[model samples]
Target: MIEFKLPETRYALNSDVSVAYQVTGDGPIDLIVVPGFISHIEFQHELPGYTAFLRRLASFARVVTFDKRGQGMSDRMSGAPTLEERMDDVRAVMDTIGSERAALIGFSEGGCMSILFAATYPDRVSHLILTGCFSRSADRLSEEAWEARLEQILRLWGTGELTKSIAPSEAVDPAVIAQYAKWERLASSPGALRTLLRLNRQIDVTAILPTLQVPTLVLHSKADLQVPVALGRKLAAAIAGVRYIEYPIGDHAVWTSNNETVPGDIEEFVTGRRDHGLLEFERVLTTVLFTDIIDSTRNATAMGDERWVRLLGEHDQIAREMVSKHRGNLVKSTGDGVLATFDGPGRAVRCALAFGSAAKQIGLSVRAGLHTGEIEMRGSDVGGVAVHAAARVMSHCGSDEVLVSRVVTDLVAGAGLKFAERGSHELKGLPGKWDLFAASG
Candidate 1:
């Protein structure tokens, strides 16, 4: 492991507020990590997960993280800073570090500020990454629910019990719970958190998502207790050409559960490649294929349980064989079919075609769709907008049909592939009408 000397914490003035920040590494890329709700630059280094996340980022880019106004070492004002004021703090940090432009990463509540910054100053952001985030505060909780929650937060602002809600994975450990309690106390005063929460309810940046020109990656936990996966999907859909990845677990804190994977994903996005070896779960840019046995429900009803199970097993085996033959990874069995990924769109398309033909040999017809994008590798399963988009495309296809997105069509240009336009159709839960194509040969 390469040793990194801790960088000195510094401050950037955003008018009356002094935002505390730290900058580390000298990688070619300039990346800024925006915090959620509260942060303390010095205190963060005490937590192993937080430290590991920072070092991993420093390994590939000159990383910058700061305490937003009214938190940590920054000036604690009488009230919370609005979205535009928060944007000024980001600009001040960039100016302090002499970073004319950089990639912005927003986690949780920080995502809202990042979105506002990126849309307001497109030329200053090369890319944007959001994790466990939401565009509208109301989407997270109802006003009545939020008011009740706020009352509770006020009653137990620094009791460390909130750790159970924010970082349930670490709440069980007494030492972790104690540290979180102290960390919360030092992160901000009770008065600040109250003001911030009240202002947070007014945040709604959904309108700006569509205007963002910078490339983006939106990641959310499938089981996130605070921010639902649906909200993250909504965020990605609103942004043109945005990539979305869903982590399997629900920990909202980036420093828990799959903390390491978070930075690795950011590295791949900004650096264009991963520095580590292949693992069961790691974010990577690839093509995803979704296939399902057509009329499986009806067939299962007619075949009886025992025979249906046997046929399903056989179908799974055939799908695995086809995926392996085409150099694809069978991510998981989707009951009636399977989901797989390939390093290239051509291979993914070919694998889908093979699955369709091979399934027909066993008196089964399959529908499949292929799409290319960056995906989050979660142990044995995969989740991302590409995965969902492929499934949507597959759902639109008929028996024995292999369909693909425009991204796939463009990538497999000369791979002896032929596609017929299926016309532009609206994919459920996704923004805009997607132009789809069916693989004719």
Candidate 2:
């Protein structure tokens, strides 16, 4: 038997609320491991799987793990809590240990919270590692599906086999599953779990996604039942600078079920040797275009399935041709909209106006918005507040209209592209108001 000594735990953060945490190991780099849902620092080492995982992590850096507020050894406060509060809990833990910055390793739903923290406080994070996570809860499951899962949790409470069912891969070992159940029971109260689930459902970090600037690694199993692999890909696609890796089918608990592969990938990503996931293009000047089909749903209904399919085929071809002609990259189609990037804002603006004109001739009207900024070009897409701002600008335009921000206007001032001031408008998910204008013939 390998004897593991428990580290001295402590608490910090003088704000009306404080958080509990523990630190262990004597490595050079500090690594903070945030729990997925329920965790207890005292009980974790007793379990072989959890113990091995932490020990392996500690091999490379000093490891810190903590019980989140309202769970484990932390103070259980009354009333429901928000994700921001949970992030603040993480901040409190770091402050308690006098750690100015550390690599964050977050698991399951904890991955989402980690992403939020990295984006909101990039400077404080040396590196970010997310496992079995998603960008937003809305993208995780359908409303009916989410409701059904919540009902199951309510009915099962502590004795329910919900954990085993949700994580079938971990069910192979009875001892491990039993240990997990025991930890879950001891880590959090039923009411706290319910509230956490509710907060998970309401959490949305899609708007702030592009703001993430630190080195990021996203790892997910193809067989994750709680959160699908598609959600992981979506998150990687939305963030400007991130690396994504997919493991063969396994449970959401990467440490236990897929321990063989998880640690190796994490080690490589952190050391900067293998950037095998998505490529991160940072601070490159580029033109961004946001286009959406006007009244697309109504048109689909009017044209019926057959004709609508034909029209969409034509629409795609036309857009692709125009993009290729201008040396632009057709990122990906967003079902009802298309996102493309260009080398110059002038050409991007021209492409947008021409696309709108071309669509109008085919009885299909399109609206587009253009902006130029230092964008992070990730594999197959662009990201940053500039992209979000461009999307918001598109939301304000009518069919066959092309809108541009003042920054883009300045970039293409001498390009002979005419413009009409649409005045300033407050954009959703963006800070402050923006001065927008419409392109004219």
TM-score winner: 1
Question: How high is the CA lDDT of each candidate model?
Answer: 0.85, 0.78
Counted clashes in each candidate structure: 0, 0
TM-score between candidate 2 and the true structure: 0.59
Tens-digit lDDT track of model 1 for 71-176: 8999988888999999999999999889999999998899999999999999999999999899998898878888998898878877787787778877766656
lDDT value, residue 109 of candidate 1: 92
Best by lDDT: 1
Q: Against the hidden reference, what TM-scores do the models get?
A: 0.62, 0.59
lDDT of 1: 0.85
What is candidate 2's CA lDDT for residue 374? 64
Question: Model 2, which residues run further than 4 Å from truth?
Answer: 273-441
Show where candidate 1 strays beyond 4 Å.
1-4, 276-441
lDDT of 2 by residue, 62-160 (tens): 889887777787887786556788889888888777788988988877877888888888888999998888878878778998889788876766652
Cα-based lDDT at residue 289, candidate 2? 93
Q: State the weakest 10-residue window (summed lDDT) of model 1.
A: 276-285
